[model samples]
Target chain A: MILPPPEPQTRRQLLRGAAARTASAALAAAAAPGAGGVAPASAAVAVPAASATIDRLQRLVRVELLLEYCYRQVLSSTILRPDARRAIAPFEGHVEAHVAALEARLAARGATLPPGPASVSQANRFLARRRVGGRLGHLRGDQDALRLLLSMEQVVIGAHFVALLKLSEPALVELSAQIMATGAQHDAVLRLLLPPHKLGSAAPYGLVQGVQ
Target chain B: MVGDGGGASRRALLGAAAVAGLALSGCGATAAPASTRPAPAVAERDLALLLAALELERRTVAAYVAGLPLLPRALRGTVQQFLSEELEHTGELISLVRSVGGRVPARPNSFQLGHPSDAAGVLALVHELESAQIATYLSTIPQLSPGPVRAAVASILTVDAQHVSLIRLQQGQAPVPSAFVTGAE
Candidate 1:
């Protein structure tokens, strides 16, 4: 998280370094018995560490927290009915499971363990008050409450895309890409639920490098 | 060494491990602990902003999962996919917070804002949340760390931008604007 910035160098430097490896890999692939281009022997290329593995894992965890907070806020907003709350049950369960899994990973990395189920509800409250209503491609509909939900989701989907681009860790970019992809689907679903005018609002505003 | 401009925020410390636990599990998708070694010197402001951003995502994931069943089957697939993405983002954030040696929040039973049972309500809430996400990221990018973190914030902002467009189109807002929070930066 606190890596010192590497000295700025030209893209040429990286490309030159990559070129050597790429050639070696190409040779190895060709030499492999029965290896085909379709299979691309040694196809597993080394991506930039920033865009590769570790950072991807890290971003995945951070984005999870963002989503959790968003949902908690929406839940507390009180615009939904009982049935809606019931529908939300699965998400809550999912969040809990996510917390457990993420914690386990941190344990593996020799990192510190964050809070557990003990404080999940507090995250929910954080969501409640944090409203993004007055800002951004603000849309309206017959159902005011529904509009609110859609807007909240829009912001989340966008946040993922941001992580994907900024993280230099290759792993993190991959992870962010995955998350961004899911956000696209969420944007779609939310659109369908919203009123016509609000349906596709996720487009120009919601795309995360088109990771979807 | 860690400087005031580099210390991790409260949420970053608390959130990493928790998010790591959830993200790896996969809500189809989506905190921190202390250690023997010293923590990184992440900017406090960046840490705080990022912490909120991460928390926001957690809530969004939770809402999507809970809301999936409420929608008709057509929307279910989309909802699940989104849930998964949110999970991934959350997972990434957990590592970030811990790396900086900051405290993050744990799971919550109920968020302060109430939830909606109606499809329309859910959509509305989603839109608003996404908007906040976009603006927040934009606002923080400038002040975040000088390198990858700032870039990461911008990347997140891009995602928000895309989200805004999609939501706009989904809402039937023709001509989804080029930007959501233009001046956020």
Candidate 2:
């Protein structure tokens, strides 16, 4: 019997939920008209908007941390070929850099850093919440590992795309786009290393909304 | 005039309608009266950026057309595919510009892209053009308001960066040399 596919865990979903919550709160405020039906000043609106951006930034930090954990796991695995290992080792460093940049941003905002997965079991639990648990342990070959990494990179791209929509600060939006573009580069390179590697698969679409 | 014809036209129509609607609705927020509503300066700025990006995309498309024959037989297919994607980017940008009530700029009859002597020269020219495209999008993203327009620009930027990575791979260099795709390199 054909079974239904598990619901994919997407950062788009998380961001959408966050956006909905923010929208609902705004709507609630709007529904309750101020004295003489006058709208609130722009300064009053700015506070919540700034806090929402911070919340989104914090979520992205958690995502980067989890991704860093996953990258470390795959790098340590013996399933990858030596050449593949050499090519992909830099990606782990990239993810670490992403984490560092995001953490610095959070610290600048005086936001607490979200704790990352500290162990393999913790990482698996994190993945399981997204319905892709035991991913690190499932690697049978180089292709498997590469495919997993490709999917992860796509997730990063999607997350940043969603975050960009609500990010108020232009600098933060620019930083997010820069990071997202790096994820796309990683996606393309990983696709080239996969089976039946072709340039077409490396860049199959002009618009990258990511796996979501 | 610079894209895959019918598809680009249809997308342009849809984009125009969507942007007009967005403008009318004050970006999906509570609509105040026309006099009280603010001017669409943000949309105009986005339109300008999209138009500039569209112009660059058109030139990049032209460069691929001019340089395609100079590439090696094995590399032609890849470059051809990249050409098609560049056309797609133009179509998307055109749609965005139209949606924001901006005039679609006239496509240049020809670009003064430098002549490449051989396959290596062609690759170098393509790389230079792609890098410039990447840099343009990176700078443009921050200026765009936080919305679908910014999202769309980011999407296109990523693809351009991907093209660069593949080109580097073909040149036997590191596919992704940097963690951040600043496009300055």
The lDDT leader among the candidates is 2
Q: In candidate 1, how many Å is residue A112 off? A: 50
**What fraction of the correct interface contacts does each predicted structure contain?**
0.11, 0.86
* Poorest lDDT segment (10 consecutive residues) of candidate 1 chain B: B28-37
Question: After superposition, which runs of candidate 2 have C-alpha atoms over 4 Å from their true positions?
Answer: A1-45, A131-134, B1-42
How big is the positional error of residue A33 in model 2, measured in Å on the Cα after superposition? 36
Query: How displaced is residue B15 in candidate 1, in Å?
Result: 22
lDDT of 2: 0.73
lDDT (Cα, tens digit) per residue for candidate 2, span A70-140: 88888887888888888888999898888777766665554556778888788777766655423778778
Interface RMSD for each predicted structure: 12.8, 1.0
Give residue B34's lDDT in candidate 1 (0 to 100).
19
Off by over 4 Å in 1: A1-212, B1-41, B179-185
Tens digits of per-residue lDDT for model 1 on B55-129? 787666655554444465665555555555555556555555666777767655434334454555556666777
